[model samples]
Target: MGHPHRLGIVGLGNISAAYLDTLADSAQIRITAVADLDTARARTLADRLPHARALSVSELVASDEVDTVLNLTIPAAHAEIALAAIGHGKNVYGEKPLAARMADAREIVAAALAAGVGLGSAPDTVLGTGLQTARHAIDDGLIGRPLAASAVMVTAGHERWHPSPDFYYQSGGGPLLDMGPYYVAALVHLLGPVRSVTGAASRLRGTRTITQGPRAGAVIPVDVDTHITGVLEHDSGALSTITTSFDGAATDAAPLEVHGENGTLSVPDPNRFDGETRFFELGATQWRPLPTAAGYLDSARGIGLLDFIAAGPDRAARANGDIALHSLDVMTSLLQSAAEGRRLELTTTTERPLAVPLTAREVWSQRE
Candidate 1:
């Protein structure tokens, strides 16, 4: 509605730095205000931005100068912040794990729909050139008729680096809910919405030790699932084996691979913005990197927000919240399936319009 979108950021945590760095040079959105439960932290971030003021959550949400609220709060706060922004007639872009529960995520969506305002969520990794290129190749029939896929993500635990890692072991921050969105979102973009899901999860580590940082040598209890493996049945008749762990060692596990009738498309780590994706034909001995029409130039958050804003008010807006909710449903089914030892059926389907194309220059120019 204005010359440039006005952005009001609600949380000034470590992850918020990434968004600030990316927005620093953008002309599309200006940081008008910032807020955090810790007023000092909010002030710190605001001090670094031009014409940005630190304020309370209520003030930020109620500010008429702010057109969009970037909900960077913790997982438990996502639904509340977004709902408040929507209630105030402001567009909202929330961080991942949209909400702690499926019902809450649905409520946020419903509120946005009722308010007729824009709603988006993050872990926008799917928009990266790596995944987008893979999507394009699959759609172009380079990997005719997807048959199956797999994704594996592992970390010793976040206590090593995160100043406050206690939440990661809580309900909203386990391996399934924490890292599952990135992989699941990519799968949805490539394969389609899941038809069913079954999973087996366990607290593989009784306690986790911080390997580095000031917290080194500190041990923390692992209350949630530290290891989870699941089977996803997609509407396209493709099966995806997904797994995540906070208790495992490192390996050169490919992030994702789609087996198709003609060949296999191996996608680089979906969590990143740029990488070479390879396609191996049935008869070929080697995997060849597919030529990208354009380079991915946006930061983790920039691409999704830019696209949503670029689509303008008339077009159907795409955001991470939709994918986050679907991912939550899949994870919920996985937990249920694991308990019952049977596949859980999913009623929703994943479908999107054809992807916008990018020129090679556009794709390559964005690389750091």
Candidate 2:
């Protein structure tokens, strides 16, 4: 485990480039193989990475050179790829929401446990400086006994710029499921596990047209809710109101915030690795920036995967299946509650994953 965690990437889409940029300099992982349903795409990516070979999806998942599967596939295919990798006795670290369905995601967790391999998933943005600073503030009582939080994400839609936008409108690709993971994960980090939720949603448009890329002006039908608003009741007695949408133009809401008996904190966007965390105490007249006291420095997407593997054999990965599954359960229940017109109690709950103290890559990926 002292050496790099050889990675077999299963998707080579737009987002894969961002990951490649991070992996280029990582100390804990390196891409050894690349795969996609589009063989040409896989080959093209492999050609660029040093020593990375192109493989079929099945081949990549089972390759002897690969230790973990990096799943960058679409939301619908996440579970399928993960199960394949886990079945081959490889660890898997994937993009957010874990999987599209609760049952499917649960299967990945169960299989990983059965195989004795670790499980992990993203928005490891929680392991970054901005949120970690806020968490430190909470732990230090800068925010006295966290009382509540609110998370908001709003955009007209992704069709304005994305080339192939069909998946954003499909069964697993609504604003809540697609984008809610970041907000929900951050909320859990800030406020702890959610116990129940009551949600209401709206879909103001039936179809959307792509305004950018090769498929410009191509219309896509919308099947899932485009605007979702809900409240999560955390097990710690903290409450959070969340609103995620692809229907609105914009809003002035902070991406995230936490309030407590002593102060309030304005958190940076959870989708990013770093930003300023602002705080305003009860007696203060102005919001001041908190010094970055924790988390990875200048971290990037793949760093979370490094952190996951660096957790050693005994400690759970900082971005783990239980937390991801809990996040998914909260989101799915919110949408279900909206559909059923009732508050739904969650069956899943996760302990807050251990917080990351400020550390460099070398120090974190080491054995004393």
Candidate 3:
């Protein structure tokens, strides 16, 4: 390892803890500062690290000590924080769905390109061995030529468990925008970018009452579609059906499956790092399990961050900001297609590459 990169993290929300806990053990990057609208929360996170301080967003971005800014802020603040980091001449790594709107996402990408700084986003979940193996199998023709795919993501609404679930029903917080990144990213990885899309969406319920956490019994109104179904036409002529909902009950199976001419590949749950992969031959009797491989150990996000740090300024990886923004566009188009009742066309595509081979130490190391 060379010199460690200094990191300043913005957003001390619920998900920030997962990233911080993983960064605590990595020597490649160091958290030099943390910032949040809630100063107390920022201090709480800062206290866990040595030589780390809690600062305001402006201070964190303008400080010369920071080389990179991790934008863990909500969807609404993604563009603001990311653009600020770029304007301050620092690299940036943000959480998924780069921005709430396509125009904002495009602006962030443009700013990063203009600054010539490293910019990336997550849902890095595809880097997990589960998806990697699936990609490998697909490429190896174990599944023959890819023909079609189906992804279904359903939830009983976040109000039941999240302390503050108001954002989930909003424009940036709907099922397609919030959870669509993972599925869309995986699809882009496996099937490439979509050429067109058609969809239908609906609001399952007008209002939802919190049933768990501190906000229990609080009712939140829904303004966005809670249920969405989309048909994606891949450039390769392959098609896919993607459906997401906030009104369904839990099921044992995953939400996505890719079918090919030779076999049907059962993917792991899109939301998880690793699960199981089953292959169903054209005329097979039952689904067969594939060999287990090294998957992500620390919530999946760490994998992309580590890769970014390792690669440094030399080369870019699959989790680059452009790919993330493309995925966001796909999701956005899905919603637009639903509204217009017309097929939406896309101008970008991403090739699905084989997973990076795992080294011995990487496979053995366990999170403390």
Best by lDDT: 2
In model 2, the Cα lDDT at residue 103 comes to 91
- TM-scores of the candidates in the order shown: 0.93, 0.97, 0.94
Error of 1 at 62 (Å): 1.4
Order of the predicted models by lDDT, top scorer first: 2, 3, 1
- The number of clashing residue pairs in model 1 is 9
TM-score of 3: 0.94
Ten residues in a row with the worst lDDT in model 1?
A: 359-368
lDDT of each structure?
0.79, 0.89, 0.82
lDDT of 1 by residue, 38-106 (tens): 999889878888879999999999998899898888888888898889999998888788787788888
- Structure candidate 2, residue pairs in collision: none
Candidate 3: misplaced stretches above 4 Å?
293-299, 312-314, 351-354, 360-368
For model 3, what is the alpha-carbon lDDT of residue 260?
97
The all-Cα superposition gives candidate 1 an RMSD in Å to the true structure of 2.6
Kindly report which residue stretches of model 1 are placed more than 4 angstroms away from their true locations once superposed: 359-368
Model 2 C-alpha lDDT versus the unseen true structure: 0.89
